[model samples]
Target: MNIAIVASILTVLVGLFYKGHKNWLMTWLQNFCGSLFVFSGWVKAVDPLGTAYKMEQYFAEFESTFSETWMSFVAPMFPWLSEHAILFSVFMIVFEIVLGLMLLMGAKPKFTSWAFLLLVVFFTFLTGFTYLTGYVPEGVNFFEFGKWGPYVETNMKVTDCGCFGDFLKLKPKISFLKDVFLLFPALWFVFRHKDMHQLFSAGVRNLIVGLSIVGLTVYCMSNYLWDIPSNDFRPFKVGENIGIRKAIEATAASNVPVLAYELRNKETGHVVRVPYTQYLKEFQNYPKEEWDAEQIRGDQTITVVKDANGRASILKFYEEIPAEQLSDYLTSHFELTGDTTVIPIATTKISDFDITDMDGNEKTWEVLQTPNYSFMIVAYKLYFEEGQENRMVYDTTYTYDTIAIEGTDSVYVERKVADVQARQVSQSVYDFDDDYVARYTEVVNPVLEAAQKEGVEAFAITAYGDPAMIEDFRHETQSAYPFYLADDIMLKTIVRSNPGIVLLKNGEIIQKWPYKQLPSYEEIKANWMK
Candidate 1:
């Protein structure tokens, strides 16, 4: 049944129930929406940077989709919006949580109802656009359905909508459908907002919600600004074994292909498609005249896998390999090589977890696959824009000039001309809290020295950027461990701190710590080294 029809039937039933038990139904609806909002906001609040990154993805998609048309007027603004994505992320999360609290407490029901309606409407539009664009290919007008080919699938630029953060990923279609269902309650609250019952007095309810907003805001800031999330929801979280995940991925990739094969005859130019199993079965005893004349065509593989939105996709592959050489090819390409081959059967979470040295040498397998404990210090960026230093440079030059007076004919005089030239100078500055750096050095240096004594490896990984900046940081801190390079996004995924610590043992994440939580040398020696 259509969602609208279902919603209409539910509304009629709800109306009938309200006639008999209006107070109970209104209270129930308020609590239900309030709980949902709280949950949604809490997940986002726990990982605000994740939400910010999602926002950046949305902004990038928007810019990419609208950059070359009449909508180009808004294209330039996306980069700026992406830059401040974290600020918007923080505000939205706080607002949602506070609104949830207000609704639950029945504080300012009139305002709450209006705000809720507006929020729902905005979300409905967002999710609607997200769903409709699946059919709209790139560089085509969104509303021009005639130009859109058959609605085979979503060609959406932004994949995940980031509605429930990392905890729950909803597909564009499902997300749109969910918003449609939510509209019923939203409309209900619009008309029956006054039916909301207050849990406390006006002053007490205001104070409660206000305190909640402040408390959650502080909690989010503490996690994002100063340290890693108290709870890690990523694939690299502690206790996850990379080797085991690799094995699972390998198994998934080894599944049989879902597509059959088509072969064309060289002499007759006739083509025939047969089931993959049947083709393999007949290959050995096939007649030489027919078999030798057969040329593969439309050979492909179809694999089904679930996306982040939990939607199954019939992923197609067009690459072809001869059946006779397939076994040899697999052995030569995948068996000996350490590189993991991605198949369409499943997604590997840690596929992109790689490490490289400054010279562009990969050391991922060496560090992660070895049966030893290692300390990886992650620093995403060495400098912040806010820490940049500006200076003005003034230059003075003297020049001798000859000029003739108006009344005097051919009268030339030597005069010294002074010119003052000013130029703006700017330099990247590292203002990474000198006291924090000092404390970090004090705690980490000893641990590194002890790890060396115990034959355990330790190293620092940062994004590929200015070598001079890395050298300066190393020299200033007098860090004993070697510093390697990795992508900043990878470092951020490793830990949500400028400088964080990750303890890995044989590709399994053992523990992770923020800079402020770095353990002492004695503690590391006693617990980890052993």
Candidate 2:
């Protein structure tokens, strides 16, 4: 149907319903839904790629689950969809914002109402699926209620629904519940769309919507195309101190283990689990010989550690026990599991921030503990293909071959051949665009030079990649700072930009700058160094 005809019909329907006292109620509902969507769309628009990553996660989990479930018919398509997640992300963000504006203005109420309902229905399906999947564990069919046994708190494949992007990470259950609640309002709009009130004249409303669409598009594009987010919401954002965070994490991790001791009756081969505290209290008065006669079957301990900064990392520590010495060791150490295993739990989100040099040596702690101010240049990858000229240098080797042949007569003939051997070679030189290298060097070298002049430390960090490529990058760019390796995801979490700069003072992030916004030496000294 033509949009103009739809708009005309919606305008007439809304006008017919406009002569009522319930205008205030409809306006209020419209604004409420409009604001909710606007906020959701705005957060995602600022970091579309972040939403894309979340979409990829959902798609991956869906692909895996679908392959095993009865939904195997559509399993192969999910991976392909995941590959184009960014495109879907952009479409959703724009659709949401446009719908929000239409709702707020009460423009084309009939169309907006139906569109909103359809969108909400789609969201409800996704969230509902996500919530239900949490109960399904590996090796068990999704529909097998008997095999599910009990409600096991298994790890979910897709933890957050990404409904509000990174701004709010709702659990799968909460996301599903939220969508369920939104259904009431969606249905209300479907029936009462005519009661919606227009806030402005038709021309003004159209202009506002047009400008909003253009402005939001430009804003999103600017953030994604050239630099990091204008506002960083990540845990490692500026002003966060890594050293203090680690210290706090360590302090929080110090917890007593909850132990359960298993003892087996050697004669009957019967095993029983006893609480560690009760066992210790009871056995304090019992005979050691009697306890030894009953073999120690298993020992299990559960410990909980919380790091307030972010997610906790669990570390399990185990110890081996000999059957002969189990009783003696348990009495002394008090760390025996049913199977003589000792479990120590410690968790931290910053564990993956571990930095390593190209040689695979850890340098994370050293870098964090440096006394002098440090400058870190993070480039997740040295992203340049071997342009035509250097393609052969990276893949081929030139060699000379000599061959001798006997003629029919008695004479021998020698032949020389210029043989081109096809084998991967370490490319010392790369064919990266000079201007691109120069642009980065111009921004980064001065900062490194300034750090050097002031006796401060500076280094470049990148994800694990070809050592030869890194060496070429260092040489071609004339980088004075040393380069180190870290996980690509870690580098991205540090800063959104490909080649961002982070200024740190004793492991505390003092300032950060995307490539386009890197400050000069004087500017840095004036604004941040003090």
Candidate 3:
């Protein structure tokens, strides 16, 4: 009834095809199980050593899962066994070879059967852990039916899984029913254990058995020696492509048109609208997707204009795309909206900010306004003593304040400052801090100043330093902006160059200014108004 049992029974039946029904099934079981032992043992020999080490790690807590009864006897000695990777690997190869050889020679099925069963039992427990921990679903069923049902259910819910010693990273959800549904050969192995001795004859039959086992052993070794299966990631293992196609067909059957829309800069805050089908054809990369095939149509809008600098302006819609397909439209740009989003307000052309603070808190501040006020965004230094000897140090933080402007929101100013700094640091380090900061002050500060003078509202800067320098660095800057910390990955993603400026209105980006050519106040105002 069980799959393994049925498969085993069928395999035995295949071996007995020429024999009559009387002793046919029994003879078939002996040869089939013998072959399986050789095959499984040889397959496992590919990375016997690595497999053993892995076994130790995953099964370290075996005693915790299983009863302490057997653990006190066999488990106590397990952990130390993994220490010598080379020795373990050698041992595994020898073990599998000997086992396979013995199985092939039909040299006492009594010994081979018990040995094979024990090995399978060990694998079963390991696989069980893998399934239970959600590493992988049940791969090779080693147990009988009544005992395996609950085990399969326990693991079937996992969607992403990997076991079989990481050679197979299985999908989490697997058909336990299919696994438990064994064929007859496996069941016959259990039933005809006493008849296993009859499989090997004295001379020629023994020779055939020896040759069969040796051949399997050689096949197993060849698989490892050449590194063949390592590259094959089981592309069709879970039928991923077929399932995706089916899901896509079902979605298409709904007859719902996918919408592609954009927001246009109609001046001021901007407006959301649908673009003409002709405009969509000219601008969209996915124009081939049917727009009117369904009752409702997908829409996408694009706004075109020129900045004060007379540069071409193209604002397009942003939507989530599949990662695999992202390369198809690699040049497409996107914008983020909603509360608590980090807007890039600068380029990677400036000094890299090593925000010592790692907290993901976005630096947000309201520009403090007094009857008499002075405001400036400072590009300040991280103290030399606080940084490493060979590392290049620079101004590590940037601050933008509204102290000079009346009615300035401190909350917004701080938030903007943090976002800008985070974006700067997000760029991977291009140069040392010392070289970068000097150039930043010489090149980027003036542009920042002009933007500040104009009612540009916000700006950001980046610098580098060790975490120990944060307080001293912050105090020395007397900055107007609140410091926000960001991850190295984030900084690297934004700018690959030096310092840059991204101007924002409300929340939408008005322009991106790299340090290559800083914008003048007149230029800033003109672009701000656009």
Candidate 4:
């Protein structure tokens, strides 16, 4: 639903009841603004890690922007911010909730107005940067406008700001517009806070706001920081079937009725219509995936077109012209947007959910499609090369002297005198993740063994660490299973733990455990698996 339409309806309702009253407008504005803030904050708090990941994305994009603009000094700051994004995510969640509640109850009108205004402005800036930077040409800095080129959809820095978390999908442009729209009420409350209607007694409002903050803190901690979100909104959430969902999506996407959009060349500003029926028939003639090398070599079997960046490719296959002059026969064509209808991988429940072995063979279907249950150990990273340092140690030395214990042993007696000094020392020991490897060994290893004993197939998948590192981790932790390769971001999405456990039965995710609270396999089998 368009928020603007809802606001209009709310305006009409408020006017119908409280016509001609000066406070009526303020009353509606405050209520609506407070509601939006509360709702947005609440959704984000449900999955705090998702918001943190989005923050990390923005920081990374900003880092790239800084580097592209030759601001090398400013680039380092983004990595630090990315590291603490989760903490910032939690803080922002709580702050938004508290201030929104305060605004709704008219507890601190002046403070809430200022905070809301600042927040909206900051959000507008972020969204504006994301939406506007598309107009900046390739190899051009976003801040430098003189060389800015025509609008290109492919140059967006950050795709979505995650304003409403995963509950709603707002494009970069739409998010910018939404924040811009909120500025009206935010500014009104800033200068005209005196006109705001008061609600509830002072003590009662205090109690409500205090409880809200406490609740939000606990909620964010439990959801992302300490453990997996209680309510999982991600595609890899428990009970999700990757294979089945993709199959279902493919079936649905095949028949989606679509009309070909008119092709427009941004550089030339030339627009042309595509014959809908002709395109609908021709687009279906070729396979949608990568084409054969032979066909792409010179077979006159493909139509070529240049992308928005002026890179030439096969119209259907999107093949780059071979550097070795493999193809000589090529026909140029105009690319049409919305020419064919298919569900984008992004819109589906599963996108980058792939499982590949070290040898580069896909195992996604073989794993998920099996009828028997299996266990997956997802280790996104396992680097711990920097060993513990600055450990306090006592340096002791002993010396023997003939004069010691003279009374007891007479002339030949020798006693040992000890001297001890405290020193800080660094040790290079096992560097297998100081944070969670011990936990994985103590908690997850046992579960893997138990699963093996129960005749269940289990394996490990990781995004980081080479084969040597994997072997070192296995030897150090006594893990006997083989490890496959997977995308790090996807592994994080699979489970919140670095080395989390995922149980699957015939394509459906049965259960997932973060590294912090990995249960015994027997307990899992007796409870969820059985």
Candidate 5:
């Protein structure tokens, strides 16, 4: 983090104090490197909530263009990724700071230069793609750089490019142009310097870089750990549009103001107002003995505190509960009958009529039911992940065809499948559902369950826009095990594989299997009965 400061000092020295015509070249390189850090830093620094909101908005429309396989991949993966968004943010911050510092200190010159150059190239490509495809309808037009190309513009509007993670308030046009401009220094950083160690020496150089790094580190810690955004840009700033006090007053006057109150603790006399609607269901009838409800949303309160330019956050005031606490609460409340104990077993299915294999002889598909075996009826939803948007479009099956099986159950499944694929952002996995289904059925499910099953029926549960698809699932696997439709995430979390299975004893899970492996009846019975 302090690397930014080191880079800043080096930039000033090179631009102003350095001797001879060397100043000219040094100034050019310095400004170029400086711009990379300043601009990228700004992009990385954008308001997280605003950035996330923008990304969410894009996904809303993006999800429509994907194949069935692609759609299932995204929905589950996106939420999981978003949950750890802070980790990504931290990584970005450290990356920018270190890169900037390395540039200033002239350390690992070739490697650093190449890395920054590559970064610039990537950004340039992404920005260009965004403009060309119009996938991200917001942000400035990078295509304009080309003298006479398809200036035949598609629909686009003014929105933050989020180049810096919505950290700065720069307009999209400015952000786009600025990022493009920084490519010069990034290029120089790669080409100019031969010996990296010359950039930093044993004495003064070390002190300057070390001091700068320390300062930046302190600044970052103060802002992130203390929940303080830059004083100049924080919402609490004098010219800021939103007001915390006003928000609080608004909440207090209305019964349903999307705000609620909660005590910091039974022992402390602290109270806070939050968007009440967010937690209404969670604490509507909460038994306070075991827990407590607060009027303010935790995130909101922290945001407000930071707005106030407060040094320590209200988060410190509140007793924070670990994630496991919530997990425990959910499990206790749901009384989820799935295996609380670890047992290994897998499920396998075989389509008796081997139409693909051209086995003309009549074959009976067997469904075996045993009291000791756990039964799981899996329904698959195809969601695409990232890096597959174009591929999904070209693949055709995701959008145009019935994602599931046939005409009777086709239309709804098609629409739902397409919708899921269209929702992916870059850096995410794509065509997840298709991959899941293919992998499980072709490889995992079959390999582990080579022994033919008898009297046990398997059915996939999924939803299309129509109720009939679900009904069809019921019809297809009639009177076997009930096909349980679950929220897409629940299904993924239950098993990392598609068409997941569970061994049940009296309707409770005794064993679970991932897609890569399925257990035989004997294996399942051995694990569960004990």
Candidate 6:
């Protein structure tokens, strides 16, 4: 593992330099752990929103678990946590970075040691839970082998624990093991807190600690609270071919999980527990008769882990293998009466991305193939403002008006369906948060109009809102372009800007601009779009 390699190198470096000291080993361990903590925390700080989203996912998962049991009293807290996930993320990033600094400088041995141990304990529980979830009988990754389950990790973030943010995606097992390894050093730091050597006098160390806390908190806030992340590590970073990235869903073999299957006969009430396999033939016949394979041990039930109820859980073919190929999937789902394991297939980092038009047409490929320069206006959510700032202004719909022109009564009346812009807006200027309103109206609208006139088509893709609300936003903002739909998470990943602009040609990202830093249409056409 990379962590192990880094630890080894640190050990050699620290040992060689500090060997003259009486307590070199302690120093070495402290340095290694401190370095790791800082790096980990910094990566998360790079895009605090990403961490916020992951926390939301975990909170939702926890909510589900708590709701399932009689101890449902605490379930409400998870929802609250989900709502305030961004705040939690910011604070956690501050703590991790500051704590790591404290440990490295030996700022306060007793305090730092206890904090480190507690942090480790919390992280271990999280990773441990995630790793153990793979064994869930209903979990797609359950003993499926060969490949991780969708539950193993969400393309390293959304579904996964996102410990290192987008910088790295260690397998759940690896993550759990890494935390386990850290337990030893953490315990030692607690028991032998006095042995830790301070790098400077108390005043200097105190000053450093205060500076670090303030600096890191500000840095983290700058990334999410006020602006887009300065660094882009996601696949959608500038210069990536999104078409090719999304295409990996079908072609990437690296993440192809061992084909897992669960089959049951509703008529006989007989449940067949089949071991996971990639081979279609082997998977199909396993229940009826013992199938051939070196991997299968004596007694299929013994080989597979039992469900929570202790009955060997049934395995269904990993769902999401494409509809045409799902002869077995359909068969199992309809013919059998068991919990159909819905392990997400192709839920890789790039696989789960898609965008569709407001009319419900999948326009992902169409957008990818759009000729010449194209602009994507991403608004993870769109609304005028909060509180009394917003009001409905339904714009574009009309009913037919019929009239007799002459004094003589004319029985006949002309009828027609009329369409106009449907919208809503703030009733008063006081209701507007001028900053956001200006971005969409002053910046986004004018730029889009100029781009379209220049033969560069622009489209807005939004999640976190329904079509009606989106229409209200578009009309309210007087947007010149059309809007589409995508997963909110995917939209957030595509660009950190809440309403960011990304330039593309033949599906490759040419450049990106946060709402605050949007370039003039002339500036873009002069540079690359033209």
lDDT of each: 0.70, 0.70, 0.40, 0.72, 0.43, 0.71
**Off by more than 4 A, model 2:** 1-28, 59-90, 125-133, 136-154, 253-351, 386-439, 465-472
lDDT of 4 by residue, 1-530 (tens): 44445545655654565543347678778767877888899888988888888889899988988887668789999999999999989999899878777776677779889999999998898889888988988788888889886566578877778888877778888899989999999999999998776566788988998898888999899986578888777778776666655543443444344455354454455555545666556644333342211111111122334445444433333223241221222111123233232223234336567778767789877777667888888887776674555689988888766564546655554556588899888854557665566766678887788788878988888984456666777788888787888887777777776677889887678999887777777688889977
Model 2 agreement with the true structure over 140-164: per-residue lDDT tens digits: 7655666643233354566567788
**What is the C-alpha lDDT profile of model 5 across 1-530, one tens digit per residue?**
35345555665666565432244454446544755575566444433333333444344333432223335556455554555554555555555666666665565567778877886776565454444443333233333334332222344332345566533455444555666887876766666756332443547655765676566555554444443244323222222111122222233233232346553434453444444664565554445764345444222221112223222222222322233432332343233333232211111111111111112221111112223333554444544343433222322234444455565654543332343323324333333345544644554345234322544434343422234334443333232333433344334323333455555432234445544455555665565546
Model 4 lDDT, full chain set? 0.72
Specify the poorest-scoring 10-residue window by lDDT in model 1: 317-326
Write down the worst ten-residue block by lDDT for model 5: 348-357
Please list the residue runs of candidate 6 whose C-alpha ends up more than 4 Å from where it truly belongs after superposition: 1-22, 137-158, 253-285, 288-348, 384-436
Candidate 4 residue runs with Cα over 4 Å from true position: 1-22, 70-72, 136-138, 147-152, 250-258, 265-346, 386-430
TM-score, candidate 3, is 0.32
> lDDT at 386 for candidate 4?
46
| TM-score for all models, in order of appearance | 0.65, 0.65, 0.32, 0.73, 0.34, 0.71
Sort every candidate by TM-score, greatest first: 4, 6, 1, 2, 5, 3
Candidate 6 TM-score, true structure as reference: 0.71
Query: Which residue pairs does candidate 2 place in steric collision?
Result: 297-338, 298-337, 298-338, 298-339, 299-337, 299-338, 299-339, 313-347, 313-348, 317-344
Better structure of 2 and 5 per TM-score: 2
lDDT of 6: 0.71
Of the two candidates 4 and 6, the one with more favorable TM-score, higher being better, is 4
| Candidate 6 residue lDDT tens string, 399-418 | 66677767776755666657
Tens digits of lDDT, candidate 3, 304-350: 33345433322331322243332222222324232222222211111
Superposition error at 56 for model 1 (Å): 2.4
